[model samples]
Target: MKKVLFASTALIATAGVAAAEVNFSGYGRFGIGYVEDRSETTIVRGPGADGLNGTADDVLARSTAQTDDVILVSRFRLNIDGIAETDGGVRFEGRVRLQADEDASNGEANSAGLNGARFSVIYGGLRVDAGNVAGSFDNLANYYGNEVGLELFAGQYSGVDYNFLAYSSTGSGANAVFFQYSVGDFSFGASYDQAQATVIGAGGTTSTTVDADRWDISATYTFNNITAAVAYGQTDAGVAGVSDPSLTVLTLGGEWGDFSGTLFVADDATQVASTDGTAWGLSAAYNLGAATTLLFTYGDGNASADTQQVAIGAIYDLGGGASLRGGIGRNDCDSCASDTIVADFGAQFNF
Candidate 1:
């Protein structure tokens, strides 16, 4: 991520338009994070009988747990890109991002700046993007490869919980539209969006403000070294007690030498809750040659079986773009009351 060239330019506003190129990369991570016992929910207001403090009779409270802790986490991101080309051979691009963390919102680090820009158009293998697009089931290739530790953590794809349509770096977010295409090893994508959300009903008071119409589609193929993919998504909440959700994903991966793996399945459905079913996972990595590497992941957490998780990690490589990661895991769900142990250690870099 670090390419730079700015020829005839008025600094990207294309003053006289002749050339443009701008690229800068991003990455940064920091760590030492751990968690074991953690649960805290508060909304106690027991007071029926004209007891003080605004309430029509109040009564609700119960949730608490706290014991283990270890923290210090961080993040930083920045990316900016711009490119141009066109005479007959089309090309144009744009991107932007700037991020910060250490608990993004509440902690308020940098408080959301940049973001919201994504533009593209290219020809040959086809490409198109608009505003903050990035949905095609969230840009499916390898379906996230299962991620592992040092915070990559997608183990079990995190139970998915469907209601897809992604890419929101603030601003124009779901003002999406996307496209993708490739020919040889096969590739394809699709996306769409329409937004205005805020729906909540039943037991949690009530709320409404519908109009949502997400979309997604994906495809991929590659033989020999494997690689297979599929995706699907939908959202359409046309009201009527709202509930219309779907997602499907499938993946298969390969690389066999110093090993590499992937296997995934997702069926994150939703009819408004219970989180629906199907979520599977497996991830692997190995490459112990001088630069070192090793990782693993496992997940299952969609409807029953007490949920699950597993992990392992390692990485080292301090050549140029830095590295050194860490991991550890154990997770369990069903609202958890028992299993949970997480760990982290890190250092990352990228220009």
Candidate 2:
């Protein structure tokens, strides 16, 4: 098992009779993994690979890995959360990610950067946010219930990675603006992103960044152990030749007794680098006895090539915010000619 150290500090200060609280928190995970047959076939990049019929044979030209792949999977995140209240009943909240262990092109560390930072100003039940804000569609569903031992291997299904609106270029982190409203058990949110305000083409030449804007809206309802959410969004590819891209996502999640899970689906448009259709997934987590839990996930990408993936994993609690985790999975293309085998064994902890 791996080991992790955690710490927290709280501070309260007064500025003109208005008090504020600042808290520090972070989490880290590490593990070992082995992967087979990994590629960027359907992933949406600039344009896309040629002959994208969603078939493996069609995309045989894709860059495939060299047989069995071994890797070390690890990540560390540190965030500072701050809250301040005004005498007028308004509030301000912000979060800043202080360090990223590995986010470089060559898998090196970034020296004290702010990768997942965001800030918000609030009044009544409405709030506005900016900087590294999450998109409404993705904020609602980051594959809520999926579980895997080694993210470098099986990881999340391809559907979660390419939500049309959640493209690889700007989905993870982007410069954006967002609005949110909360009332009792219901909440609503909307986001607009200018993630690529300056576009540099293949040759590092400058191009107009007007067409890179994107927007989306989402709603979530939670009552006890049951929750439901829906979101819709669109993205413009900036340069012409392809249609504008869009996505509609829905999720239903619930927990009863010792069982909990999530079901989701997505309708995608502007399938520039992926299948031109719909995708869906289901995940389940069941507690066994006192300290062990079982995890399962299944997914289907309703593309011309019929993509499907599944994973089976388990978790063993070690108390004090740590757990032993491992899983083995297989992903295959029924209509196409591609397949993958993924496995990992490791430990994770939260602080």
Candidate 3:
């Protein structure tokens, strides 16, 4: 009986090893900041905030700051991904993420959050991806520099920083269907999504509902170091009081020796009451050496309360998946305060 049990355990272990595969890769960034002028009327809020009533003063007055200098942390994330294969050319992949300073505050570190997961199958001339992931219509545009700039035209408002028509909210995990056809450097694809919005509020309370349906199509052409693409997207909101929004974007991106840049423009078909706006952004990065790089960006929006920003930054790789980054940015707004400055420095590590 003991020999039979041992043989069964050995067989199971061998099968497990044979059926499993492992790959690990992730990136992390962390830093400290000091904003000379944090006196803005417009406030930044969490993704769950109700309206645009929150202000920078609300956050700064509550958080601890030192004299004219305040400690700030921004955009830190750690992610791990895993994949396992099954029968019939089918595969499953999952990812988990930890965000420390998503709020750009110096407070306690936030916990690990689920980024996304997906299941896929492939055959000749056809591929299907169904699960929770970034949508097809999402714009891959950089609206600002590495550290302190904001995405003015990312959403309907100057302060809103997401291209919702292009990207679905991932609170409850949206369902996405994607189809693609490829031949050489020319390819085309389309995606459709129908997902329920994540619900907040306990007991009886008023909550903002985001039941959005979206569709997107894209085509790309590539030659040498230059790649250009055009994409169109639209979203229909089922919830009342929210306007259905549609957007069209054109992007041109390329990489040359030691230099890379992306230029993007997006026009919003339906704008919010106070913010009907079109947005444009330009971002470029240049490598100075094996250890140093430079980045610059500019973004502007056409809201009645127009906003614009400029940023410049430098990063130095320190080996061992660690680096140093710093930047300065200036923001000017018509509705909010006229001008503000942001400065930050930080070190990052990954394993």
Q: What's each prediction's TM-score?
A: 0.30, 0.75, 0.70
Put down candidate 3 lDDT per residue, 1-351, tens digits, no spaces: 999987775565447545444445556665667666433233444323333233222232233343434555645555555555666555555554544443333334565465555555545445566665455454232322222322111121233233453322224346576766667887676778875554444421343566667787877778898777777777776666767776666667788899888776767565574455676777778999979988777766776455566778777889998878777777676677457776677776667
Candidate 1: clashing pairs of residues? none
Model 1 scores a TM of 0.30
lDDT of each structure? 0.75, 0.68, 0.58
Error of 1 at 39 (Å): 36
lDDT of 2 by residue, 1-351 (tens): 122222222212444445687777877777766666533223323422333343222323444233326556667767788888888888888887765443312233445556555778999889888877766865675445566664533323445434423312212366678888989999998999864545544433333555667899999999898888998887777666767678777888898999988887877665554566787888888999789988888877767554677889888999999988889888776456767777877887888
- Alpha carbon lDDT at 30, candidate 1: 86
- Candidate 1 vs candidate 2, TM-score winner: 2
Two-way lDDT contest, 2 vs 3, winner: 2
> C-alpha displacement of 161 in model 2, angstroms?
6.1
Off by over 4 Å in 1: 1-19, 22-81, 84-132, 135-157, 167-212, 215-234, 237-242, 245-269, 272-302, 305-307, 322-351
Higher-ranked by lDDT: 1 or 2? 1
Worst 10 residues of 3 by lDDT: 148-157
Query: What's the C-alpha lDDT at position 102 in model 3?
Result: 38
The worst-scoring run of ten residues by lDDT in candidate 1 lies at: 1-10
Q: lDDT tens string, model 1, 100-155? A: 66651122245547878889998999999998878886788666674666667546
Model 1: lDDT equals 0.75
The reply for model 2, stretches above 4 Å from the true place, is 1-18, 37-68, 99-112, 141-143, 150-157, 160-172, 195-209, 238-242, 304-307, 334-337
